[model samples]
Target: MHELIVSPFLGNHLVVRPGSPKGLKVPKHRYLELQQAAEADGAIPGWLHKPVLRQWGLDLRGQNARPALLVRDTVSHEYGRASYEVNMACNWECPHCYLGLKEDTGMEWSDRELLLYLLRDAGVLWLQLTGGEPTIDRQFPAVYSLAYELGMMIEVLTNGSRLHNPLLLSLLTERRPYRLTLSLYGATEESYDRLTQRRGAWKAFRRGVDAALEAGLPVELSVIVTRDNEHEIDAMYDLARSLDVRTREYNNMTPTYFGSGETLSAQALTRGGQRGVFTGCDAGHTSLHVDPLGMASICKVARDKQLPLLTEGLDGLSKLGGIADQALLRQGGCSGCQLSEQCSTCMPLAQRYRQANAPLGSYCQHTPKEVTTA
Candidate 1:
């Protein structure tokens, strides 16, 4: 459990805490000084004494002040954030899951370590650990600890199934992820169990949520609105209130990553709303994503192409910006569309909708001038 993490973030020298977003920038020389100090049991640098004490409440001047610090190596190239799918195995069978086939396998220990180190070297500071259910992965703790040690602030996206497990709970409590996002299927047992197709799922979820909040973990609830559970949406919000945690709602469903429309069947027809204007995104330019097998993509949705991280290593990321650029272009089905300028869906996402043969109303604007004659 290090008190401070000193690393290079997006070409800037930064000092960040383990479970917090607040960061302070320091000069390169000072960053190098702290890196050297971390290697030896030397005095805290005079320039850092006040800011460190004021921010973290650690008195570097105290005789007993032996602040545990971790200094990460600088990277020549990098992104600011990334999401890694730790595993595809889940304890529940929610039909709305966009993963399609869920496999219970991941990289070997050595390759897993390499992936984290690569992420570190690529300058990924905010790392998200997601999965079919990341908590259930046998190697989750090791993967999470390695990412933390590599000076990345971690966020975990889980189905809330294994959060109550003693070993897993203890590990999370001690390490303290910046946030633990749990997906809420329904407010009560009947709808929840039916929706997830897992008996006693509501009970397990309640236990996990309670234990996490009681343990002072930063927990957020994601209310997944679907046809089966939309009736209980109000109750779901009430449940989040009762638990005194922040909550977000997901009203629309996307097709499977493989372009299958099966998962979209769960969307609540009434709640299927328009996405905000797709001005643009910083996907590969400022952020990236990686799957369980070390396949790096621009993001989760536009994953038709990927970079094999295990094979190409960090240097391979140089091509990611080009991939991202191509994904945003109005090509294929969207090419020559009249309303493309103001369209909310990007080209890659529109491609998924078209692949599924989804109704135009599901994603495209319904105006008369929406599309041009071919």
Candidate 2:
């Protein structure tokens, strides 16, 4: 079971990031008072009944079942929710793919088990598994099984191509994931093939989703917005809703497709321009992305500048400062830009401004004149 901590944060209600527990503030002495109350009658304050709070392990019955704090002299470290990019091996090669293609060098199962053990030890109650196509991994089932057994609510991110595989479907049926987030590239068969550049992929995606839903597994769809299928977004939305579950729209393929030196399709460029400010990135501080080789970074975009988690373990936390530690852009395109109040420029897209080959302006075509200078 996951455990939560009550600690002080930015002068308001508690803050709960992905991998960390919810931190609720109380008068210092009131902390013990609540714990005692929990012990006496499991009386969790009504304020603790936020849905997200309950998801992070707060007992609504007012019972505080968090593990007793260890009497350690060392200053504590925060390790909350985790995301593991099990492999870069995907079955599809959509033109907009940033990493180019998947690599075959897989992580060892022993190390995989070890990573799970470490995460569970750190009180990780949620684990997200994504990949080029995580199901393509031969050992995916084993790794996912271990995570499930560890009591972590598991989320599998897939391109929806191979969910129809018998073995993978069997495993999913057996373990039953918290949710299967299907990355939908298009609304129609032709559009899916055009966007994903895979023959019969749309058929496979449908079969997979149907299999999961038929097996009584919860499924959600997130349409991957790209020039190839941008026009079909509404159709995709209608399709998603027809499935009778949650649905969402993802990336316009602009800032997200940075670093690969690829420009957006003229379509994606025009339908969307940069916003006045954009700061939704929640990498290093809240989320951790670990590649198959054990390189852990704040997010997939910043993987090149990552730390090897196998060697550093918890001690590596100090070295994992994300966007804040990054140097100023060459022209300082993102520096002192209050447009960040309205600017969509984040570290990954900001880093591209320094790349001679990068279509920096294309990513942020809407930057106002005054805020353009660092």
Each prediction's whole-model lDDT (CA): 0.86, 0.64
Runs in model 1 deviating more than 4 A are 27-29, 46-49, 53-58, 63-67, 372-374
Q: Which runs in model 2 stand beyond 4 Å of their true positions?
A: 1-76, 254-258, 266-270, 274-276, 280-282, 322-324, 327-331, 336-340, 353-356, 365-368, 372-374
38-153: candidate 2 lDDT, tens digit per residue: 45544455555675355555444544434321111112444456788888877777876665545776678888888887666544556889877888888899999888666566
TM-score per prediction, in order, is 0.93, 0.74
Model 1, span 245-272: residue lDDT tens: 8998898888888788998889996686
What's the true lDDT of residue 144 in model 2? 91
Span of ten consecutive residues with least summed lDDT in model 1: 58-67
Candidate 2 has its poorest 10 consecutive residues by lDDT at: 66-75
